[model samples]
Target: MAASIDAYQREIGPTAGQGTESRDGVLSSPLERLSALHRISQSATASLDLDSMLMTVARVVRETLGCDACSVFLFDPSSDTLVLRASIGLNPGAVGRITLPLGAGITGEAALRREVVPVVDAVSHPSYVDYPLLGNQPYRSHVSAPMALRSPDRLIGVINLMTIEQRTFDSEEVAFIETAAGEIAVAIENALLYSETDAELHNRISQLSTLRQMSRLIASTLDLPQVLELVSRQAAELTRGLAVEIYKAHPDDEHPPELLSHYGAGDDVLTDRVRHQVRGMVDEVVGALGTVERSIQVSPGQRVEVMALPMLTGRRAVGAICVYSEKHLGDDPEFHGMLHAFSDSAAIAIENAELYDEARRGWQRTSALLQEMHHRVRNNLQTVAALLSMQARHASSSEATVPLYEAVGRIRSIAAIHDVLSSGSISETTVGVIAKHVTDEASITTLPPDTRISFDVDADDVWVSSREATVLALLINEFVSNAFAHGFSDRSEGRIEINARVSDDVSVVEVKDDGAGVPDGFDPGETSGLGLQIARTLTESDLDGSLSITRRPEGGTAVRVTFRSRRLPEDTIT
Candidate 1:
C-alpha cells in the first residue's frame, strides 16, 4: 500500500503527508475507513449499479469522519453546478445549500487550488462559511481535497473532514481524505451509467409492447380514421412526449402533403404545422423528401424548435408525428432514439391497416367478376367442343377420326377448369386441377391406378386477376398434354412433379418429368402444335416472364417458367 502511494505520489506530486507531524495515538475509525477505501481503489472491476455505488461512497465518508452529516455532490458539467446527489445523516432541507462554488469555503478553496487544506481552526480561515452540519457549535478543525478521478479535470465536489476538536488535522489524516475523494469520483461516474441503462431498458420494453397492441387493433378493424388516431396516440404515450400529432397525405397533392390524423397540439402548435411547410427545409437540409423514417430535432435559442418523426405506410411517407415543448425537455442521443422507436411502431400499424382495407375491397370486386367470367368461358368452350364432335362424325378414315377425337378431348379439358372455378368461394383454382385434367384427357390414366402425378406447391395462393389466371391455367395444361403425348407413351409406372413458388414478386412454376427426358434434337418452339405456341406466347409476353428447360440431375426434363407479380412484395405474397 505504501509503495503504491509512493508511485502515485511521484505522478501526482508528493502528498500533503510528505513532511508533517504524525500523531502516535488517534481515533482508529478514520484509518480503518481509509484502509477499506484503499482496498476498493486497488480493484479494476466496473460497477453498473448507480445507486449502490453512490451509496457505498457515502457510507465510507460517514464512517471515516465519524460525523453525523456527510453528503456527495457531483458537478453537472453542462449545468456547471455542484449537484447534491447522495446524502447520509443530513436533512433533506440542508441539501439545497450543499452546493458550493470554486472558492467559497475551505472545501471550495481546496478544489479551486487543486490541493488539500488542513485548517485546525475554521474561525481563522477567511473562506469558512457555517455549514448546516455543525449546528450552532463552532467548527474547530477541517480538512478538504479536490476530486480529480474523472475526465475533463474539473472539481466534481469536495470531501470535507470536519471535527469539533481544536486539534489539527495533520498530514497523515489529510492524505487519507484526499485518496477517499478520488474514489468518490469513480462512484459518481458509475452511478450516471446505471441511471442511463435503466432509462434505455424501460423505453425499449414500452416500444415493443406498443407495437404488439397496435398490431391486434389494426387486424380486427377497418375504420381508417380510427387506425390513424390509435397509431398517433400510442406513439406519443410510448415515447413520453409532451404531445403527438399525425398527418395523412393525399395521392395527387402528395407533393404538398396534407395532415391526416393528429393528436396533442397543445404543447407545440408551430411544430405540428411545420411538417407540411417543409418545402424549403427539405430543399435546404436533408435533400430528399420522398420517404422519411428518421427523426429530426432542432433547437432555436433556449426553446425547442421541433421534434419531428416521420411515419411511413408501405414505401411512401403517409404522415409524420410531431412533438413539441416550451423547454428542452429531451435533448440527448438516447431520447432521440426513443422517439425513432415510437415512429417505427406507429408506421407499421398504419401500413397494415391500409393493406387490410385494400384486400377487403379487392376480394369483393374480384369474386363477382369471376362468376361472370366462369359463365361466359364455359359457353365458349362448349361451342368449340360441339364443333369438334361434328368434325369427328364427318371423318371417313380411322386415322383422321383419331385426331378429331383428340381435339374433342382438349375441349373437355378446358370445360373442366370452369367447374373448379365455379365450385368454391375462391375465384382461383390450384395448378393441381389443371394438370390432373390434361393428363386424364390425354389417356395418361391408362396406366396402373397406383401411379400418381404430384403437385408440389411452395407458395401462398397467388390471386391473379381474370385474364392472367385463365392464361396461366391454359399454359400449364398445354405443357402437361405435350409431356403425355411423347415422353410417357410406353411408361406404365411414372411420376410428374409440378413445383411452384414466389420470389421477389415473381411466381415460378417448374414442371419436371421422372420419365424419358426431352429428345436430342427437339426444340419446343419448333412444334407445329398450336397448344405449345399459345403457352410460349402467354409465358413470355403476356405474363412478363421467361421459359427455361433443363435436364434434371436425376434423369428428367424440368420446364421452369417465372412470372412477375402485379403488386409490390409484402408480408403477404399475393
Candidate 2:
C-alpha cells in the first residue's frame, strides 16, 4: 500500500507542480508567484455562486502551491462546526458530508485559534485526526491556513494542503500559502456580497411588479364588489399567502363593520376570538387615522397576528383591511409600509366607484326632467301652429292668410328644435336632421297648387351645440320660405335646392332656386320684407356668419351663408 501510495502521490505531485513553474526549469520567482495569485484571484471571484467559487479557489490553490492534496472547510457559526466544502485528494464524497467541531482536528484548531497549522508527519502529529475512508497511506507534510477577512481577522474558513514528501514547509512557501488564503477570503466575501445584493434587487423588482398589477386590477372596473375582491387577492399575494379581509367601516361607530372581501387560508382563522380582536384593532386604526397591529390566540394552541390599515380618502376613513399571518408581522416596518400603500389604492378605488354610482343616478334624474320639459314645449308650439291654422281658415283674404301661414311656419321651425332635443341628448344636436325637417315643412306650407315646386335638401350630418343648432335652423327656415314665395313666383314650375357642407372648419349652407333672379340692385339688408330682414339678423347676430345673394347665370337667385362650425367637446355630451 505504501509503495502504491508513493507512485500515486508522485504522479499527482509533479503534474500539479507544473502550474507553478516555467518551461526553462528555473524555480518560479516571487514575481511569477504574485502573477499566478492574480490569475487565481480572477478565476475564484468570477462567479457569484459561492459553492462553485469556493471549489474553483480550492482547485487553483492546490495546483499553484504544488501540493498533492487540498481541502477547503467553511465554518458555520450556528452549528459551531467546520464543514468540508471542497477537496482534491481526500475522499471526494466527504465534501459537504463531513463536519468537525471547532477544536476537534488540525483544521478545527486552526479555525478556533485563527492561526496556521503545519505538520511534517501527519501520522506523528498529536493534532491529526484519522479519516480511514481517505486511503491508507498518510500524507507526511501538511499546512493549514485560516481565512480571515476583517480587521479583527474574523475566521470564516480553513484551507489545508498535503504532500507525500516528509519535508518541512519553508517560511517562503508558508507565506505563499498565506497569500493564497487572503485571495480566497476576498473571493468568498465578494461572492457573498454579490449574492445578497442580487437577492435584494430581485425582491425590489418583484415588489414593483406587484404594485403595477394591483394598479391595473383596481382601475379596471367601477364595480365596488369586484374592486374589493381584487384588492383582497392582491393583498394576499403581497403578504405571501397570508389571510386577508377587507372591511368597510360604517359611518356610525356603534355599527359592526361590514365585511367587503376575504381571501386566503380559510374562515377558521377568523374565529369569533380573532374577529373580535381584529375589530378592536380596526377601530383603533380608524379612530387614530393610522395603522394598528396586534397578535391574538384564536384557539388553545393557535395564534394569529394581524396588521390593520385604514383606507383613507383625504382625511376621512372609509374602510380598513386586515392582514393575518401565522408569523408576527408587526415589527417589520417594510411590511407595514407596504400595507399602507395598498390601503391608499383601495381608498381611491372606493371613492371613484362611489362617485361613478352617484353620477349615474344624477344623470338619470336630470334626463327625466329634461324630457318632460321638452315634451311640454313641443306641445305648446304645436298648439300655437294649430291656432294660426284655424285663424287662417276663418280669414277669406290672401293678405291675412299669407301672414298666418308664415307665422305657422315659424312656430313649426321652433318646434323642430325641441323635436331634436327630445330624441337625443339636449347638450348637442345634429344639423342635417333639422335642415331636412324644416325644408319639408316649409315646402308644404308655402307652395301653391298651380306652381309645382320641387324641394331637395343635401346636408352633411354636422354636430353642434344645441343653442347653435336652434339659430341655424331659424336661418334655414327663412331662406327656404323666401325661395318659394318670391324666387319661383313668376314661373309656373320651379326647383329649389338646399345644400349644406362642412369645410375649412366652417359650415356652409346654400339655397338656390331656378326662377327669376333677385330684383336688380336689391340688397339683402336693405330688403323691405320681414323674412329677408329676419334671415340676415339671424345669420350675422346669432350664427356669427355672413349671407349673400347672387343671381345665377342660369336665370335664378342663389343665397349662400357661411359660419364657423362650433363642435362639442369629446366625451362631454356623448
Candidate 1 accuracy as lDDT: 0.59
Prediction 2 global C-alpha lDDT: 0.78
* Candidate 1 Cα misplacement greater than 4 A, ranges: 1-24, 27-36, 39-56, 65-69, 87-89, 131-138, 150-154, 265-308, 323-345, 351-574
- Against the reference, the lDDT scores of all candidates come to 0.59, 0.78
lDDT of 2 by residue, 510-557 (tens): 888888888766678777888888888888988899999988888788
lDDT of 1 at 407: 65
Tell me the lDDT of model 2 at 492: 79
Span of 10 residues, lowest total lDDT, candidate 2: 18-27
> What RMSD does each model have against the real structure?
13.9, 7.7
Predicted model with the maximum lDDT: 2
Clash count for candidate 2 is 0
Clashes in model 2: which pairs? none
Q: Model 1 Cα RMSD, Å?
A: 13.9
lDDT per residue (tens digit) for residues 1-574 in model 1: 3343234234433222223343333434666655766644533124556545554565555454453234555565675556555554434344445666667777678877888888777778898786544241333666676767657665666655444345565466567667777776665555566678788787667767776777677566656678878877886676555555565445565364445666665424445445544433332222332323323343343333345566654455555565544444455666566565556656666777677778867876776687668767877887887787787779998678756665666666666676556655444554555555545654432233444555444333554533555666666666665556555766755567765666676777778777678765557677767766777888888888887766666876788888885643332323
